[model samples]
Target: MSSFKPSMSEPKSPGSYCGVPAQRSSQWGPEMVLVKLEDCSHPLELNVIVKEEEEERGIKEEEEEERAFTEEQRAVTEEAEQRAFTEEQRAVTEEAKERAFTEEQRTFKEEAEERAFTEEQRAFTEEQRAFTEEQRAVTEEQRAFKEEAEERAFTAEQRAFTEEQRAFTEEAEERAFTEEQRAFTEEQRAFTEEAEERAFTEEAEERAFTEEQRAVTEEAEERAFTAEQRAFTEEQRAVTEEAEERAFTAEQRAFTEEQRAFTEEAEERAFSEEQRAFTEEQIAFTEEQRAFTEEAEERAFTAEQRAFIEEAEERAFTEEQRAFTEEQRAVTEEAEERAFTEEQRAFTEEAEERAFTEEQRAFTEEQRAFTEEAEERAFTEEQRAFTEEQRAFTEEQRAFTEEAEERAFTEEQRAVTEEAEERAFTAEQRAFTEEQRAFTEEAEERAFTEEQRAFTEEQRAFTEEAEERAFTAEQRAFTEEQRAFTAEL
Candidate 1:
């Protein structure tokens, strides 16, 4: 062989520490060759495989933690919903209590109105009775006055008759006893002259007495006539007074009825106004309750959605952390495999490097897929949670509106019923008033009939009296009746 020294351009040695081929070297030592050979066979490197396996385990644990966090989030959501339901129930209960109180108030007001109406009716009846009694008293006074007048007239007539009878008897006795019966005529001439003079004086006295008697009789007759005329005038006045009294009584009854009707109408209007106010209050309360319930439900929904979102975010964060960790582990694995490339003896490092690059690409692709899936899942869960919360809120609002409408309908029905009751009560009151008025009129008529019958009986007993006396008594009775009627008026 030609003394051959390996060229610097020759391929690198397999076991050289530097880039050189192996050579038989006596300058160093034979042991160095064995040591070098041993070193070459045993490759020492920073082992990264164990660390990669540990990183993978850590990633798995992180995923498990994320799952546990999601479970805890679900439990929290359930607790929130339960609390919201309890609050809603409490609001509903409070609204019901308010409605009951309003209803009780309405009932009390109606009862009070009815009591007042009854009191008014009682008062009216008492006034009517008082009026009737006053009429009776007036009639009695008139009758007493008439009877006294009639008695006085009768006595005067009797006295006049006696005086007339005595004058006739005295005239008859004088005429029967003649002047020739005189026994001793002292002087015929003197007796004749004295007798003549006495006769003339007697004649003059009789004429004067007759004139006085005529004047007395004329005066008595004129007094009786005047009395009869006064009685007639009193009778006419009494009749007019009675008519006026009746008219006044009728007017009073009419006015009372009108007032009662007005009162009833006013009461009905007040009742309606009260009912309307109550209905409005009830509606407001119901609406407020509905709004409160809806708000509570919305809050509950918002809370649940927030909890769900929080849980989702937590899960996403954990997944993102796991992906980051996995990426780091893959990069570390690739770096460690690259370091081993330089240590490998005679191995095709390019092939191994290519395989590692392919594995790294594969792992990167897997990590990308996992991250995308986690992001997509998180978005879907968020959308689903939001939709569910919206649906719950909408349902709550609808339920509240329906309940409010029903309450309003109930209130309207109550108002209608109250109005009907008021109308019926007014009608009853009017009917009762009419009946009382009729009773009063009937009583007055009975009193008048009794008075008339009494007068008739008295007249029958006084039939033997002079016509003038009877007329005077009748006139007096009539005048008394007029006075009573006028007093009543």
Candidate 2:
């Protein structure tokens, strides 16, 4: 064996096959070789030689042609695969968008449902408020009726006095009574105007509340519209509009019911009909909302999308909640105002009643005082008239007695005159009994009318003043006449 020669190292070109050099097997023909250089004794490793280059050039030309065909096939395959992958990714993205949109719609529907529920609760509360207002009106009416009854009873007691006194003071107090009537009318007018003002103010407040509700609704609608625009779907917008219409109708019904509560007359049929309609409509809306929610769950989405949508939904819910809270606050304030108004009205009415009572008491006192003074003056005049009448009657009786003694100087004539006197005395006694009955019927003998008392005094001065005064005066006149006659004899 030749002296051991050092084996040449393998090529270090960049091309490799299972860690083998590209310059491997240069002596072999243009074909793959299974040779291990380390197994060869004195392995001869060579660079790409001339024969190998020429053969390699020829083989490279063929490989280039084959490579071009293979490259064309592979490019076609890669393009097909890329197209398939792109289609699948696009399908996934569209599915994700659909899922996200469905989830957002579901969330929106849930929020809408919550708002509707809240609105329903508010409507119920408003209905209760209306009922309470109706109760308050009824209570007020009852109170007014009670007050009127009491006032009438008081008036009846005032009228229970003697008719004689009324006549005495009728003309004197007529203007005052008329003034009181006018004052009462004015008071009633003031009450009516106050009630009207309260109604007007309530209407204005309701209008303001309606405006606030409309503004809130408009804002909510704007948000919904914006959300619809974001969704870019016509179906969603229609549904949202339908929901808004339902909510708006419900609100309108609530307002109508509230106004209906103020009606003095109760119409139960119409109210029940409206309530039934509202209930049916609400049921339908709930069914529709539920259907919509069920339909929304048929898709899928990403966590980030869900998070964003949840945030938006939370914000909307927060806005609704805030509006509800504000509405509650407004309602509470209105209730307080109404309560205060009622209390003030009661106080005003009580004060007016007390003032009226005071005025009436003063009027009655003045009337009594004036009547007493008139009676005193009339009594004085009656005494003077009686004194003058008695003197004239005494002179006439003296002349009559002289004529009677001259004309009736016969026994038969005296007997006829005595019979006539007896009949006249009986008639006078009957007349006295009649007067006594009349006096008893009047039930106020001492407080008889001025005309009756004066007539009685004048008649008694001519005949008998309540019988007792005439009897005593006649007895004294007889005694004086007897004394005079006896002195003359």
Candidate 3:
């Protein structure tokens, strides 16, 4: 018998023939045979042989068995080779399908990346165009504003110049009028002062005259009172001397009456003495006759002669006293008559002086009243003259004030007219400024609308271009995939 050996061309998988095992044949001696593995794509064959001593006695039987085994082995080798060839063809077809799918995926990714880069470029160009347009519009607006400001400044300068000229002329006119009014007021004040001075001087002179007249009247009154007092003293002196003379005359008359009574008594007594003497003689004669008869009557005749002598002497003395008393009474009566006449004269003079004094006092009172009336009339005349002067001054002042007011009214009217003209100019300038502002706003609105319309048109065109590019890329990818699929088939 021979041991089994195997030959390999290349390395193979470990479990390629997992289900097949080795077996021995009973009819044949112990020998190795060449056998092919079945599950592998390539045929694997091995050869072996066996030798024996009793083989001549059964030679025919062994020769027949060998021929049958050779035929069976050849059939198995052919079947294994056919199955390996089918498996090789299926593996080559699958490799070609995988390479086609990988090429399609790479092309689609490259197309998508190119589309995104183009979109970014388009957006950048649009942003740059919008910025340039905005800068141009800003420059144009600045130029327009500069021109409008220059025009407004020119108008303002002209208005200021005209206003300054008007103000200068008005100031000059006002200064001239003020000077003229001042001079007129000064003259009026001086005239009023002179009139007041004259009135004051006249009043002073009248007052002095009134005072002098009053002094003269008072002096006259004093002199009249003095004369009346002196007359009264003289009357009183005459009355006293008359009263003294009357008292002395009455005393002398009383003594003379006593003397006259004595004289009458003496004459009567002498006659009585003579009668007695006669009676006594008769008696003596009778008695003597009687005595002579007796003694011769010698003694009786002597006694009768002595008695008659004594009686005659007493009678003569009484007659002288009566004649002296009669003379004294006559003188006394004449003195009493003279004293009564003197007293009457003194009373008459006092009465006359009192009447004269009363008359003088009445005259003085009348003169004083006349002087006061004259003074009052003079004062009234002075007051009337002063009132007339004051009225004239007031009239002149009123006329001057009216003239000044008229001039002021004329100046005020002129100023009001100038102010009205200035207001009109200001209103016109304000209206012009409003018109310019409205025009500027209208222009800005029109420019903004135009810019919006242009931007909308550009965006629409960009969108259409992007859509066309995407459609073309999709068509090219489809054609490439179809061509690769056909080649694989």
Candidate 4:
């Protein structure tokens, strides 16, 4: 033998070296070959020979493997480049799909954003249109309210002014009526005065005529009484003279009888018996004559006493007539004095009535003056009130117009808030109108109540006065009746 040559060491494949050794290893490929080793633990390494067939086979197999790997890689480059090349392929494909999905998501998000933006724009436009419509409606309502208020104010002012004018005219007419009443009363007073004066004059004339007639009758009675006294005195004087003449004749007859008796006695002796008897008869005749003379003287003295007593009675009667005449004169004078006194009393009463009338007239004049002044003041006050009311009405109208203009301006300036502003204005106007209406009603009620109270008081006073007048008239009638009955008694 050839000298023992050293064998070339072969690669060993890994096996269980302690238990058993590997016999052989199958050929895997050029990348991995199977081999068994003698002292190697098992098959530690795989060895391959580079023969044509084997190489061809290996190459083919390698090519086939490569081809398969390339296909897998394509399915995974399509799948992952078959693992490495397949893994590279798979990574590339996954990256491309991710990029495509991201692009789709981005496109979808953009479309959605566009749709939302369009919807928001439409809603905003609708809200703006609604706000504009509400503002217009409020403005129209405010305008209508202001116009109606102005019309109401105009009507109230017109009515109040007409009432004031009518009241003023009525007061003026009342003043004229009072003046006419005063004139009529004055005329009545003058007529009464004239009638009283005429009555007084007639009474005075009648008294004067009665006095003249009484004086004439008194003179006649006085003359008759004087005539009766004179006649009685004359009759007494005639009886005295006749008795003196008869006494003188009786004295002469006695003297003649004495002389005849003395002559018979001296011549009677130696004459004769027949002569003696004749002398004695003559003596008896003388004695008888003496007795007759005594009787005649006694009768004449009794006649004188009777005639004196008769004359005295006639004088006493004349004195009584004189006293009667004096008493009559006194009564007539007393009656004249009483009549004069009555006239004076009547004149005094008339004066008092005149004074009362004058005082009443003065009071009436003063009242009239005061009433006139009050009326003038009232007229002035009413005029002022009317003017003030007119001015107020004008001011109210102007304010209303201004308010209308302001509302228009506000509507234009704040068209968006016009509805709210108009509501506030309307509420304020309603409150003011209610207050004014209440005030007017209160004033009317107060005025009517005052007028009613005054009318009631006047009626009461008139009734009282009428009752007093009736009572006084009844008393006067009773007194007059009593006086007439007494006079008759």
Query: Candidate 4: where is the Cα deviation over 4 Å?
Result: 1-83, 165-489
Models sorted by lDDT, best on top: 1, 2, 4, 3
lDDT top scorer: 1
Model 3 C-alpha lDDT per residue in residues 100-188, reported as the tens digit of each score: 46546644764574456446535643554464355335433543543344345324433432343343335654564356436635753
Candidate 1 Cα misplacement greater than 4 A, ranges: 1-276, 344-397, 408-412, 443-489
Per-candidate Cα lDDT values, in order, are: 0.51, 0.49, 0.44, 0.47
Q: For residues 1-489, what per-residue lDDT tens digits would candidate 4 score against the true structure?
A: 001112245454433353353343445454333333445443334343323334544654675587567555544542332245445446756865785586577548645754564465356436534643553354345435433543453344334323423433357545653564476457546644754574465356435634643464354335434533543443353345334433555466456436534643542342346335534643453455345434534543454455346435633553563455446445644765576577867677755665575476458546645754565466457545644654564455345534533443333234223323333433343344334445545645755765575567557656755765675466556555644643342
Candidate 2 yields a Cα-based lDDT of: 0.49
Model 3 spans > 4 angstroms off: 1-89, 145-489
Estimate, for each residue in 298-406, the C-alpha lDDT of model 1 and write its tens digit: 6646655764675476456546645654565466557756755665564567558757765775686576567656655765675576567557645754564465356
Cand. 2 TM to true fold: 0.23
lDDT of 1 at 128: 40
Q: Per-residue CA lDDT of candidate 2, range 1-489, in tens?
A: 011123355634333334343344534544423222443333434322123335545765785587568657756865785576568557756865785586678568756865775576467547645754664475356446534653553354335332323542356455654665577568657756864675466456545644654574465446434533533443343345435534656468456435534531243354357447645754564465345433322221232255346446644654564455446445644764566577866677655665575477558757755764564466446535544654454355345433432332232234334434533543454455345445445535433554475566457545633464555466557666654753452
Clashing pairs in 3: 32-48, 34-46, 291-294
Q: What does the lDDT read for residue 306 in candidate 3?
A: 34
Q: Tell me the TM-score of model 3.
A: 0.19
- Candidate 2's C-alpha runs over 4 A off are 1-489
